[model samples]
Target: MSAELDLSPEVPEPTLLESLLYNGFFLGAIVQLLCILAVIKPTSNWYEQV
Candidate 1:
């Protein structure tokens, strides 16, 4: 019971490196999706530009 009541007040938050890593992976997924779409439809201007 004492241990449960003694929890630290500090809350875990994402660090800059963690945020960067998450965004990098997210961007990578979007790029991969675009590439796949481009393969399926080569004539679209958006796909061509990518």
Candidate 2:
């Protein structure tokens, strides 16, 4: 029974570097999305003005 339990694989936890990279990527995506919206907003306003 102990041998069978030992045979089970343990789940790996995320390291500090991995967590930082993951959060960085998430924030980068949000900033990029906001930038895209900003660019589109000006264009939309310009179109309305015409």
Candidate 3:
């Protein structure tokens, strides 16, 4: 069984780094959200280009 929203193709095999990057995006997103909620995320005032 898998998550219902997964639309990615079912590859016969996946490289470790590929899996790591996939999970990293999700993990990093969660951490970023937490930081934002805690008001610890850097502000746009600190970076003009961003």
Candidate 1 regions with alpha-carbon error over 4 angstroms:
1-11, 44-50
CA-lDDT, candidates in order = 0.90, 0.87, 0.85
Tens-digit lDDT string for candidate 2 (1-50): 45544667788999999999999999999999999998877654567687
Candidate 3's residue-wise lDDT over 1-50, tens digit each? 57678789886877999899999999999999988876975556757666
44 Cα displacement, candidate 3 (Å): 25
Candidate 2, residue 7: lDDT: 61
What is the C-alpha lDDT profile of model 1 across 1-50, one tens digit per residue? 45557567898899999999999999999999999998998874776687
Q: Judge candidate 1 at residue 6 and give its lDDT.
A: 57
RMSD of each: 6.3, 4.0, 13.0
Best-to-worst order by lDDT is: 1, 2, 3
Can you rank all candidates by TM-score, best first?
2, 1, 3
lDDT of 2 at 35: 99
What clash count does candidate 1 reach? Answer: 0
Q: Could you tell me the TM-score of candidate 1?
A: 0.62
Candidate 2 yields a Cα-based lDDT of 0.87
Model 1: how large is the Cα RMSD against the reference?
A: 6.3
